[model samples]
Every structure is written in C-alpha cells, then in structure tokens.
Target chain A: MLKIIKPGLLTTVQDLGRTGYRHHGVVSSGAMDRNAHRIANWLVGNNESNATLEMTLMGPIIEVQEDALVAITGADLSPTIFGKPIANNRPIFLKKGSIIHFDRMKRGCRAYLAIGGGINVPKVMNSRSTDLRAKLGGYHGRSLVAEDILYIRKYSEHTKHTISHLRNQANQIDDFYQADWSVGRVSKIDNTYPIRVMKGRQFDWFTKESQASLVNKQFRITAASNRMGYRLDGNKLSQLKSQEMISEAVRFGTVQVPSDGNPIVLMADSQTTGGYPKIAEVATVDLSRLAQKKPGDMIDFTWITHKEAEQLLIKQEREMKQLLVGVQLRSYR
Target chain B: MEYKLSPMGDQSILIELGNTIDLATHDIVQHVVTCLDSMDHAWIIEYIPAFTSITVIYDPVQVLEIEANPFKSPYHIVANIIEEQIQQIAVLETKKQRTIEIPVLYGGEYGPDISIVAEHNHLTIEEVISFHTAGEYTVYMIGFAPGFPYIGGLPKRIATPRKTTPRSVTPARSVGIAGEQTGVYSIESPGGWQVIGRTPLELFQPNDPEPTLLQTGDKIKFKSVTKEVYDHLEAKLC
Candidate 1:
C-alpha cells in the first residue's frame, strides 16, 4: 500500500489503455509514454500491461506503507527516498514508512512508478486505465489527490523473488537499495531523431507549400495541449481546396488540422471520430518520443513510407520481447 | 460504393467507404464493419465505424506471420485480407436494424437554441418539430463523446449550421443539429451544435453491459411530447 502526501501534478494509474470501446465513442486514455510505463513495470518484474502511476511534469510524494520492490522510469523527476537520491530505470526496495518524493525534473515530461505488485484498481470495460474526460476507470476515474490510499495487488512469482532479493539488500543502504545493474528504457532521449509521420487520408487537401512547411518547419507544443491532443504552433497550413468533411474514425497519433490552421496531434485521450482534415499521422514507433516532449518543446516531422513504419514497429516489438527475456535471465542470477 | 484503404500508422488502417455522408454510404460502411467482425481474426483488436469509414486496429506482429515465413510488413498483408473480405460480401444481405423512438420535449428552457434553429430555416417552431419527427434517421456513428450518436435523415428544410459560439455546457440528451446531421448529447459537454430539443431517455450508462442505448447501424425517430410527459420520464429515469 502507498499513501499520497502531495499530489504534485496530474497523476493517474494507466496501463496499455482501454481497447474495443472507440466504436461507442470512448477514448482509450492510457500512459502517454507507453515505453516508459512498460519499462517501469518490467523492471519491477510486473507484466508490461500492469497499471503504473503516470506522473506528469511534477510528481507526487508517496509514503510507502510496506516494504516493496519498485522502479521509476521515464522522466528523471529527481526522486529521493527518505532524503537519499535514488536512480531511475532500476528496481529499488523501499522500507516501510519510507517517503518517496519527486523534486525537480531533469528531462522528459512524464514518469512511471511501478511497484512489484501492480496497482489494484477496479477495471472498467476490461481496463484499469483512467479516461479523465469520460470520468471512468482507474482510481475513481480521475487523477490522484493527497490522502488517497492505493492498494497493490498480489505479486507475481518473479516479483516475489525480486522482493526477497531486495529485502536482503535493504540493510546495505540507509533507506533504500537500488540494484547495481539497470536496463535501458525503451525510448531514448534523442532530439536529433526527427518525429516520423505518414500522409493521412486527407493529405492532398493541403497546398504544396503547407505540405512542405509541415515537414521542414519546427512546431512548438502549446500549453493548451493535454492527454486529448497536442495543439502545435507552427506555420499555418493553408489548404489548396477546402471542403466540408464527414466525421470519421480517428486514433492516437492522428495529426488533425482544424479551421484555425494549427495542427493538433491527437493523443491517448483523443476523440474517436473527428471532422477536421488529417494531414499526417505520427509513426507508432515515434509516438513514445512525442510523449516525452513538454510544453514549448520544438519538434520537426519527417515523412516515411507505410512500409518503413511497419518495419519500425515490428523491430521495436522484437526488441521489447528480447528485453523482457534478458531481464528474466538476470533475475535467475 | 468504391472504397479506398489507407494506413493509419502500423497498428491501424483507415478504410474510406465514400466521400459524402448519406444512408447508402453509411450502410456500406456498416456492412464492411460487420464483415470484418465475423472474420474473428486473432490479431484484429477493434473496428471503429464512422459516417463513411471504418478504422481497423490490429497487432502487426500477430497478423504479419500468416502470409510468409520470414515475416514481411503487415500493412499490405492486412489490406489484402480486408479487400478479400469485402469481395466475399458482394452479395451482402441487409442486416436487421433497430428503430429506437426517443421521446423529446421541443422549444423550452431545456432547448435554448430551438427558436434560432427554426428562424434559420424560416419555419415555425411547430413545423420544425414536425419535420424532425417525420423523418427516420440512420445512426451513422457514435463519437465525439460516449454514446453520442451522429444520426442522418434530418429534413433538408430544417437543416441548419452549427452555432458559431459553442455552449460551455450543453445538457445531456439535448437534440442538436449541425449542417446535415442531427444527434443527441449523451453527456453534458461543450459543443457547437444548434440544440432544438431534449430527450428523456438515458442514452448512456457506464455500468451497463451495453452502455450505449444506440449503435452504429440502429435507426432513430424523434417523437415530440409535452413537458409534463418529459418530466414524468425524466423523473422515472432519475
């Protein structure tokens, strides 16, 4: 169990998100940075889809009610246990009554905290993820607040083993003990790598100049951005010919251009259907990178073929499977 | 109707059945969705059917293996499978659809924009209500919010553009019109649609096995009722 002392910013339990609900207009609200969430869960020997706390820009101060093995992944929120700084992307054991506090963010916009046992929240529509706008799922279907107590589920076999190992090492450190070795998070911090996109169904609606500007110019993430979508401030994309469009199915990573010309990249909690013209869709492999971008962060897009995007996705999935196996092998030692 | 298939990232594909929103195109879209649903492919996760399109969300790794030994790209492979499915449904039979009659109260505080909608179409408030109730609307899609159905078949004479300044809180069950489409607000949300009436039915309930009262292929008909009847139904629902 864990108790929230200070809910610094928006914090909610998220998994892989709600699936099979878009047909009824339900948005699949989950972790913005899926890579980070998976890594955090895996490091603590939990399933990749296990619910983890998704902490934004700022993070909450949690009081550990029991000795547990846990990990912090994604953004480096300068986390400390009982006044001692802890590392990210590695499993650490927190003693009972130890308070975990997240201070200044070194990089990235979101973080994931995964305990050995997953967060036990009632699943709605076959998912434990929270959809804030719909006000459903997760911890009361909303963000975490101070004084809220979160329960942890029964630990898996691997988590039990890790917990025992962590207990043995607790005496080595004052408050907590992090494992010597660490696995790299799925997403890497590489601003040099451009965000890849594919032409959308209405790609030809935009003029040649707008098409060129979309790829060449940099767009700044505006403050209006949220889980719903990222409102990008960039060169106004003017259409060659404008026409009213029928509302159609839209998904995560869809880049929609509204009447105002600003591009809004639909995120995890985006509406299932939209009438706005979609110019491009962010590549699945690049979506995790986009999730790490904070407000005012400038980003550029590069066009990629459909085949390339699929290949990248396949490659990432293969690597993730390998990472899980590698971690499992290490646990035996 | 001719359809075009486009890739929406690696996990999903967008199938545009037609360019315009009409009954024929909507039926075709729904037909394709039904066909895909029966396929029961392991990799296929969900199908999102809209006015004139269906987006298939699937697992690339799972679907890419059936065609080849060395695992090729899933984009063209999935598209090919979908095209094959569409071809098999050439002699598609029209599926059974439900016609849900929604009881509504027109022109009251619950419907603040009813007068403006009637004025825009140059019709009396009674005529506006009659026109809306006369036509049987086809549910094109459920989107924007949970269980918010975008229904077609509004009388062309009563069609009006959406409000320029959207309301911050349009109450739930508010019947609204935007261009050629009309729908009910399943939940309280900020929207631009010109509202003309309010329904007494609870369109959505989260805990229910089938949360939404209406589905994509369902038919809808509005029945005008007195405020007394509306109150009775609303109170019963509460």
Candidate 2:
C-alpha cells in the first residue's frame, strides 16, 4: 500500500487508456508521456499497460506501507528518500515506512511512477485511466488527495526476485535501494526541435498564408493548456472561406483551428468528435515530446509524410522492445 | 461505396464518405463501420463512426507482424485492407433497427430554457412540446459527451438557435434542441442548446458492462410524461 502524504499539483492513475468506448463519446484519458509510463512499468517488471501514477508539474509525497519495488520515470521532479536523492529510469526498492517526496521540477513537466505489481484500481470501461470530466476510472474517479491510500497488486515473480536481490544490498542502508545500471533518459526534453505533423483533412480549406505560417511560425503554449488540449497563441491562421462543418472523428495530436483562428492541439483527454477545422496532426513519435512541454513554452511545427511518421513510430516500438529485453537481463544480474 | 481515405495521424485513418450530412452519407458510414467491426482484425485497435466519416485507429507494430509486406508502411497496409474489405461489403440489412422511446417531462423547473425555445420559434410552450414529440428522430451519432445522442429530424416549427451564452452546468437527462438537431444530455456538461424537457431514463451508466443506452444508427422517439411518472421512474433508477 502507498499512502499519499501530499498530493502535489495533479496526480492520477493511468494505463494505456480506455479503448472501444470512443464511439460512445468517451475520451481516452491516460498518461501524457506514454513512453515514460511504459519505461516505468518495465523497470518494475510490470506490463507496459499496467496502471501507473502520473504526476503533473508537481509530484506527490508517498509513504511506503510495505517493502516494494518501484520505478520513477519521465520528468525528473527530484525524488528523494531519507534526504538521499533517488535516480530515475531504474528499479528502486523502498523499505517499509519510507517517505518518498518529490521536490522542485528539474527538467520535464510530468513523471510516471510504477510499482512492482502496478496500482490496484478498479478498471472502468476496460481501463484504469482516470477521466476527470466523465468521472469514470481511477481512485474514486478522481485525482489523489492528501491521506489517500492506494493498494498495490500482488508482485510478479520477477518483482519478488528483484526486491529480494535489492534487499541484500540495502541491509546496511536506512531507507531505499537502487540498481547500479539505468535505462538512461528516454529522450531529452528540448523544445528546440520542431514537432513533426501531417496535413489534416481540412488543410486545403485554410488560406495559403495560414498554411505556410503553420510550418514557419513558433507558437507559444498558453496558460490555459491542460490534459485536454494546448491552446496555442501564435499567428492567427485564417481560412479561404468561412464554412460550417459537421462534427467528425478527432484524435490525440489533432491540431484544430476554431473560428478565433488560434490553433488548439488536442491531447490525451480530447473529445471523440469535434466540429472545428483541423489544420494538422502531430506525428505519434513526437507526441511524447509534446507532452513533456509546459505552458508558456515555445514550439515550432514541421511537415512530415505519413510513411515517414509510421517508420518513426515503428522504429520507436522496436527500440522499446530492445529496452525491455535489456531491463530483463539487468534484473537477472 | 465511393470514399476517400486519409491519415488522421500516424496511427489512425480517416474514411470520408461524403462532405454533406444526409441519410445517404450516413448509411454508407454505418455500413462501413458495421463491416469493419465484423472483421475484428488484430491490428485494428478501435474505430469511431461519425456523421460522414469513420476514424480507424490501428497498431503499427502489430500490423507489421500480421502483414506479409515488410516493405509497405503500416498505414498503407491497413488502408489496403480497409479498401479491399469495404469494396466487398454489401449494405447490412439483416441487423434489426432499434428505436428507443425516451419519456420526457417538459416545461417546468426541469427545463428552464423551454420558454426561450418557445419564444424564439414564435410558438406556445405547449405547441413546442407537441411539435418536438410529434417528430420521429434518428440518432445520427453519439458524441460530445458519453451516451449523448445527436438525434436528427427536428420539426421546422420547433427549430431554434443555440443560446448565446452556454450554461456552465446543463443538467443531465435534459432534452435539448439546437437548430435542426435534438438531443438529450446524458451527462452534466456545459452546453448552449436550448433545453425544453428532462428525461427520467439513464442514458449513461458508467459501471454497467454496456455503458451507453444509445448507439450510432439507432432510432429515437420522445414521449411526453407527467411529473409523477418522471419522479416514479427516477426513483426506480436509484
């Protein structure tokens, strides 16, 4: 069990997300940085789909109720135990009654914390991801509050072995133990590289200037950004002609331009359908990078072919599989 | 069966049946969705059917494992499969249509905007409710919110524009009209549609195995009921 000592800015349990419910208008609410989430789960010897606690700009202070193996990945929020700094991208063995606190943002905006057996939360609509708007999944369908106690599932065989191995090393230590080797950071959180995008269905409807500016301009993520979308403040993209459109299917990373001309990049919690004119869709490979970006951050966009995007995604998936194998070998050692 | 397929993103393909929203376009959309659902390919994650298009989301890595063509991109491979499947798909006539009757309690505390709708349409509150109930509505799609049905075929006499300022909290089960479309708010949300009545029936049940009461291509009929009936049905739900 893990008790929340202080429930930071925003922390919710998430997996891959609820599938097969979008037709029913259910949003796919999950971890913003899925790559990091998967890494955290893999480090703890859990399936990538296992639910992990997704902490936002701030992170929660958790009190360990039992000796458990865990992993912290994504944003380096400066996690510490017994005033000793803990490293990310590796398996960590926490002693009972240990206080794990995350202080100050060091690099990224969101971090993922995965326990050995995963967070034990009732699945709603086939997922444990917390959909705040619908009040559907996660712990009572909401973010963690102070004093909230979260139960952990029974550890896997690998997790148990890893814990015992780490325990031997931590016998002399007071609070926690970690592996000497690490997965290293997945990707550097830098806004310098342009986020790649493909032209949307309504791309032709936009004016020539607007279409050109889309790739050339640097848009600043507004303060109103959240899990739902990032409202970008940049060059007002105008259309060739004003037209009304029927609501159609939209997805995460869809860049929709409303009547106001300011583009809104849909995120993990975006609605299933939208009537706004979509200008571009960010490539799947860059979605994790975009997720790491905070409000007031500047970002640029670049065009990429669908084939190129798919190739990038396939490459990433291959690397992820290799990393899993590497982690498995390290665990045995 | 003429349609255009484009990438929604790297993982999703958008099938645009037509530009206009009409019965013909809707039929093709439904046919394509039904056909895709029947196939249940391993690579296909999920597909969402909208007014005139369907977005099919698939796994790139899974597609590579299943398909023989290693040279072809996952998007192209999935597109080929969709095109081949859709070409052979005949209109599904065997599936029986379901028309759900929603009992609504009109014009009172439950519907604060009933008077607004009536005034805008130059009709009495009673006339507005009669016209709304008189029309047989078709569920074009379920969207915007969970289980919220976008029912088409609103009577011209009762058609009204959406509120200039949307309510921060439009009560759940409120039957509303915006322009030519009518729908019931399955969940409490901010909405601009002029709500004329309230329903006792639960459209969204999050805990149930089948969460939504309505689905795409389903028919809908609104039957007016008294406050007593509303209270009794509401109590039964609890």
Candidate 3:
C-alpha cells in the first residue's frame, strides 16, 4: 500500500489500455510511452499489462506503507528515497516507511513507476487505464491527489518470489537495495530521433508539395497538445482536393490534416473516428519516441514502408520479451 | 462491391468499402464487421466501423504466435486473413437492426441553435422539428466521444452549416447537425454543430452493461416531447 504525499502535475493510474470498445467510441487511454511502462513492469516482475502510476512532467511524492519491490522507468524525474538518489530502470526494494519524492524532471515528458503487485484500481471496460475525457476508469476516474491511498493488487508468483529474494539479500547499510543489473540505455530512446511514419488512408489527397513539406519540415509540438492529440506547428499541409470526407476510424499516431493545414497526431486518448484527412501515421515503434516529446520540442518525420514499420515493432516486442525472461532469471539468482 | 485494404499502422488496417457515404457503402461496412465479430480471432483486438471504412486493430504478437516461424509481416498476414474471411461473408443476409427512439425537447434553452437551423433552411421552427422527427436516421458510426452516434438520413431541407466558432461547452445529449451529418453529444464536449434539440435519455452511461445506447448499423428516431415531459425525464436522469 502507498499514499500520495503530494500529487505533482498529472499523476494517474494506467495499464496497457482497454480494447474491444473502439467501435463504441471509447479511446484507448494508457501510458503514453508504452516502452517505458512495460520496462517498469518487467523490472518488478509484474504482468506487462499491470497498472502503473504515470507521472507526467512532474511527479508525486509517495509514502510507502508496505515493504515491496518497485521500479521507476521512463523520464528522469530525479527521484529520491529519503533524500538518497534512486536508480531508474531497475527493481528496488522500498521499506515500509520509506518516502519517495521526485524533485524535478530532468528529461522526457512522463515517468512510470510499477509496483511488484501492480495497483488496485477498478477495471472499467476490462482496463484500469484512466480516460480523463469520459471520467470512466482509474482511481475515481481522475488523477491522484494528496492523501489518496493506493492499494496493491494480489501478488503474483513472480512478484512474491522477487520480494523474498530482495529481502533475503538486504544489507545493514541501507534498507533499500537495487538489482545488480538494469534495463540498459540501449533500450532507452532519445526524443530527437526522427519519428518514422507511413502513408495514411488519405495520403494521396494531399498535394505533392504538401507531402514533401511534411517529410522535410521540422514541427514544433504545440502547447495545446494532450493525451487526445498533439497539435503540430509546422508547414501547413494543403490538400489537392477540397472535398468533404466522411468520418472514418482513426487510431493513436494518426496524423490528421484539418482545414487549418497544421497536422494533429492523435494519441492514446484521441477520438475513435475522425473526419479530417489523415496525411500520415506515425510508425508503431516510433510512437513511444513521439509520446515522450514535450511541448515546444521539435520533431521531424521520416517516411517508412508499411512492411518496415511492422518489422520494427516485432523486433522491439522480441527484445522486451527477452528482457522479461532475463529479469525473471535475475530474481531467481 | 470493390473495397481497398490499406495498412493504417503496424497494428491496424483500414478497409475502405466505397468512395461515397451512402446506405450501400455502410451496408458493406456492416457486413464486414458482423462477419469478423463471429470469427472471434484472439489476435483481433478491436473493430471501428465508420461510414465507408472499418479499422481492424490486431495484436501483432498474437498474430505471430498463431502463425509459425518465418512469416511475412504480421500486418500483411493479418490483413490477408481478414480479407479472405470477410470476402466469404460479404454477401450475407441482413441481420435484425436495432432501432432506438430518443425523446427530445426542441427549441428554448436546451436547443439554442434551433432558430439558426430554421433560418438557414428558410423554414419555420415547427417545420424544422417536424422534418427532423419524421425521418429515420441510420447510425453510421459511434465516435467523437464515447457512445456519440453519427446518424445519417437528415432531410436536405433542414441541413445547416456548423457554427463558425464552436461553443466552448455543449451540454451532453444535445442533438445537433453540421452539413449533412447529425449526431448527439453523448458527453459534454466543445462542438461546432448547430444544436436543434436535446435528448432526455442518456445516450452514454458508463455504468450500464452496454454503455452506448446505439451501435453501428442501428437506427434512430427522434420523438418530440413537451417541456413538461422533458423536465420529468431530466429530473429522473439525475
């Protein structure tokens, strides 16, 4: 169990997200940087879909009420346990009375903390992810506030084993101890990397010049961006045809070009259907990189083939699976 | 009966049924979605049906597991499988479509744009309400917000352009129209649609087993109610 000491910025409970409800217009609201979220869970030996705390920009100061194993992944929030700096991307044991505080965000936009047993949140539509727009899921369908209590889910075999292993190796110098190894920096992506995109449903609707500009120009993330979509301030993409389009299904990373010409990339909390022309779609693997980008951050898009995007996603998933196995083996050791 | 299947991303594909947004095009979209729902493929995560297209989201990892080693991209593989399966049931018998009647109060504070719609169409407020209630609208899709149905079949006479600057906060259950499309705001959201009426029944209730009252391929009819009846239903909603 844990209690929120000071809820910073926008801290909410999120999982892999709800599925089988897009047809009903429910958005798949989840951790923006899924790569980071998964790593946090893997480090703590939790299921990949286990609910974790997604701290955006700033982070909350939490009081640990139970001795448990946890991992902090994504954004460098300068986290400290009782004034001692804690390592990210590795499993660490937290004493019952330990207090966790995040001073400032050094890098990235959002951070994730995964408890070994996950978080106890009501699963609306088969997910614990918070959809702020609809106020449907998560803790009371909103962000965490001061003094809010959070309970852990029933411990899994992996979690119980990991906790016992860490406690057995406890040291006299410190009550908390981090795992020997961690998710390496090789897996940690940089926001500066060119986001790869594929041609969308209405890619041909845009003029050739507009298409060229889309790939060549650097777009600054607008301040109006949120989980729903990222509004880009870049070269205005004009379409060759002015015909009104029928509303169609849109998903996360869909780059919609409205009448204003500036592109808007739909994110995790975006509406399911869109009427605007979709000029391009961010590649699945590159979505994590895009997700970490903050307002005013510059981003460049590079076109990739549909086949290439699929291969890249498969490769990332394979690496994550391998990492999970390695973490499980470490817990046993 | 021509359709195009295009990859939206690594995990999803957009199957375009036709060029237009008419009943015939929606029929194809409905047929494909109904067919896939019966398949119950574990790899298929969700399906979003629209006016003339359907987006099929699949778990690439699950697809890879289903297909043994050395397969082409999962996106291509899943698309091929879906294409093949949907083709078989493209000409299926029409299923019993669900029809929902939404009780609405036309004009006054609940429908501020009612006068605007009447003026734009060069018709009396009474005529606008009569025409809107007379036609049966087909639920083309549910989107924009949770359970917000995009209904078609609005009479051409009463069609009006959206407000230039959208209202900051349109109350939930506001029945509005923009151009040829008509929809209800299932939740309170900023919108540009010209609202002509407001429904008493909740179109979207998260607590309900089926949150959305309407679904894709359903039918909708607006039944006008007196202000007294509207007040009674509104009071009951709370």
Candidate 4:
C-alpha cells in the first residue's frame, strides 16, 4: 500500500485507456505520454496496460507502506528519497516506511510512476483511466488527494523475481535502490523539434494563407490548456467559406479550429464528437512530445505524409518491443 | 452507396457516407457501421458512428502483426480490408427500429428555459409543449456526452436558438433543443442548448452491460407526464 502525503497539482491513475465505448459518446482518457507510461510499466515488470500514477507539473509526496519495486519515467520532476536523488527510466526498490517526494520542475510536464504489481483500482467501462468530465474510472473517478491510500495488485512471477534480484544487491544501500543502467530517451520532448502533422479531412476548407500559416507559424500553448485540449494562440486561421457542420467523430491529436479561429489540439479527454473544422492532426509518433509540453511553451508544426506517419509509428512500436526484451534480460542478470 | 474515405489520423479512418444530414445519409451511415461491426477485426479497436460519417480507429501495431506486407502502410492495409468488406455489403435489409418513450415534465421548476423557447417561437407555453410532443423524433447519433441522444425531427414551430450564455451546470436528464436538433443530457454538463423539460428515466447507466440507453438509429418520442407520474417513475426506475 502507498499513501499520498501531498497530492501535487494533479495526479490520477491511467492505463492505455478504454475502447469500444466511444460509440456511446465516451471519451478515451489515459496518460498524456503513453510512451513514458509503457516504459515505466516495463521497467517494473508489469504489463504495458497496467495502471500507473500520472503526476502533472507538481508531483505527489508518497509514503511506502510496504517493500515494493517501482519505476519513474517521463518528465523528470526531481524525485528524491532521504534527500538523495533517484534515477529515472529504471527499476527502483523501495523499503517499507520510505517517503518519496518530487521537489522541482524539471524536463517534462508530466511524470509516470509504475509499481511492480501495478496500482489496484476498479476498472470502469473497461479502463482505469480517470475521465474527469464523465467522473468515472481511476480512483473514485477523481484525482488523488492528501491521505489517499492506494493498494498494489498481486505481483506476477517476473515482478517477484525482479524484486528479489534488486533486494540482493541493496545490502549496502538504505531505504531505496535503483538499477545502474536505464532506458535511453524514447522520443525527443524538446520544443526545438517541430511536431509533425497531417492534413485533416477539411484541410481544403481553409484559405491557402490559413493552411500555410498552420505549418509555418509558431503557436504558443495558452494557459487555458487541460487534459481535454491545448488551446493554441497564434495566427487566426479562417476558412474560405463558413459551412454548417453537424457533430462528427474526433480523436486525440485532432487540431480543430472553432469559430474564433484559434486551433485547439484535442487531447485524451476530449469529447467523442465535435462540430468544429479540423485543420490538421498531429502525427501519432509526436503525441508523446506534445503531451510533455507545458503552457506558454512555443511549438511549430510540420507537414508529413500519412504514409510517413504510419512508418514512424511502426518504427516506434518495434523499438518499444526491443526495450521490453532488453529490460527482461537485464532483470535476469 | 457511395462513400469517401479519408484519414482522421494515422490510427483512424473517416468514411464520409454523405454530405448532408438526412434519412438517406443516416441509412448509409448505419449500413456501414453494421458492416464494420460484423467484421470485428482484431486490428479494429472501435468505430464511432456520427451523423454522416463513421470514424474507424485501428491499432497500427496489431495490423503489422497480422499483415506480412512491409511495403504497405498500416492505414492502407486496414483501409483496403475495409474497402473490400464494404464493397461486398448487400443493400441493407431494414431492421426493426427501437423507439424509446421518454416521460418529460415540461416547464415550471423542471424547465427554466421553456419560456425562452416559447417567446422565441411566439407560442404559448402550452402550445410549445403540445408541438414538442406531437413530432416524432429519430436518434441520429449518441454523442457530446455519454448516452446523450441527438434526436432529430423537431417541430419547426418550436425551434429556438441556443442560450446566449450556456448554463454552467445543465441538470442531468434535462431535454434540450439547439436549432433543429433536440437531446437529453445524460449527465450534468455545461451546455448551450435551450432546455425545456427534465426526464425521470436515466439514459446513462455506467454499471450496466449496455451502459447507454439510446443507440444510433433508434427512434425517440417524448410524452408529457404530470409531476406525480414523474416522481413515481423516478422513484421506481431510479
């Protein structure tokens, strides 16, 4: 069991998210940075779909109630135990009564923490992801608060083996111990790299100038952003002609321009259907990078062919599988 | 049935069945959705059916595992499968449509915005209620919020514009009208629609096997009920 000493800005349990419910207007809410979420789970010897605690800019102060193996990934929030810093993207063994806390704003906006056996939460609509709008799933369908107690699911054979291996090497250390080796950067989160996008279904509906500006102009993430969407402030993109549109299906990374002309990139918690005009859709490979961005951060978009985007995603998935194998082999050693 | 397929993203394909929202377009959308549903491919994560289009979301990784073709992108591979399946689809045999009767308590405390709707149409409160109940409505889609049915066929006489400033908290089960379309809020949410009544029946049941009470292509009818009947039904059903 783990207890929340201080529930930072926002923290919620998430997995890969729910499917087969969007037909009923359900939103697929999950971790913003899925690559990091999967890495955290792999490091702890848990299934990729296991629920992990997703902490926002500010991370929670947690107290371990039992000995457990865990991993922290994604945006480095400067996690520490006993005033000593801990490494990211590697397996960590924590002793009972150990208090873990994150102190400063570091590389990314969100961090994922995965335990050996994963967080135990009743799945709603086939997912443990917190959907703040619908108020379902996750821990009571809400963010963690101070004094919240989280239980761990039963550990698998792999997890048990990994824990024992780490314990054998922790004789000289106290409170916590992390692996010497760590997974290298999965994807670039730095804003210097432009996020790739594909033309939307209604790309031709916008004026040529507006279409060019979409890729050429740099947009600043506004303060109004949330799990639902990132409202961008930049050149107002206007359509060639206004058309009456009925609500249609939308998904994460869909860049929709409303009547106000500001493009809002729909996130994991966005509604299933929207009536706005879609100008572009961010490439799936770069969604993790976009998820790591904070408000007021400047970002530029670049055009990519649909085929290229698919190839990029396929390549990333292969790399993730290789990483999983590498972690498993290291656990045996 | 002619359709155009486009990419919503790398993972989703948007198949536009028609250009307008009408019975013909709705039929094509339903036919395509039924075809996709029956296939049930492992790569297909889920499909969301809207007014005139259906967005089919698929897993690229899963597609690669099943298909050995390395040159073809996952989108193309899945799109090809969909194109092949949909082309062989025969003209849809009309299935029995399910019509759900929603009991509503219109006006007074239950509906604060009924007056706005009545004044906009220059009709009396009673006239608004009669006209609303007289028209037969069809569920075009279930969207915006969970189990929130987008019912069409509203009487033109009672159609009104949405509220200038939306209600921060539109009570659950509130039947609202925005433009020519009308719907019930399955959950408490911020909305811009003009609410005219409240229903006692719960549309969204998260614990149920079939969580949403309404489905796309279902028909809907509103029947006026007294406060006592509403109370009795609310107590018995809820």
What is the alpha-carbon lDDT for the whole of candidate 2? Answer: 0.90
Lowest summed lDDT over 10 consecutive residues: which window, candidate 3 chain B?
B86-95
**Residue B3 in model 1: lDDT:** 82
What docking grade applies to model 1?
A: high
Work out how many backbone clashes candidate 4 has.
0
Q: What TM-score would each prediction reach against the true structure? A: 0.96, 0.98, 0.95, 0.98
Q: Which tens-of-lDDT digit does each residue in A292-320 have in candidate 1?
A: 89889998999998889988988898998
Could you tally the backbone clashes for each prediction?
0, 0, 0, 0
Say which docking band candidate 2 falls in.
Answer: high
Pick by DockQ: which candidate is best? 4
Q: Give DockQ per model, in order.
A: 0.80, 0.85, 0.79, 0.86
Candidate 4 lDDT at B143 equals 86
User: What interface RMSD do all candidates show, one decimal each?
Assistant: 1.0, 0.9, 1.0, 0.8
Candidate 4 residues A174-274, lDDT tens each? 88878888888673356677999999988999999999999889999999999999999977999999997778899999999999999999998989999
Candidate 1 Cα lDDT to native:
0.88
How do the residues A1-333 of candidate 2 rate in per-residue lDDT, one tens digit apiece?
A: 999999999999999988989999999998889999999999998988999999998888999999999999988899999789998899999999999999767788999999999999998999999999998899999999999999999888889889999999986656888888899645456666899999998999999999999999899999999999999997899999999988898889999999999999999999999999999999999999999989988889999988889889988888888899999999998
Once fitted onto the true fold, the runs of candidate 3 whose alpha carbons sit more than 4 angstroms away are: A171-175, B69-71, B234-238
Compute fnat per model.
0.86, 0.83, 0.86, 0.85
Candidate number that wins on TM-score, 1 or 3: 1
Clash pairs, model 1 backbone: none
- For candidate 3, give the lDDT of residue B49: 88
RMSD of 1: 1.8
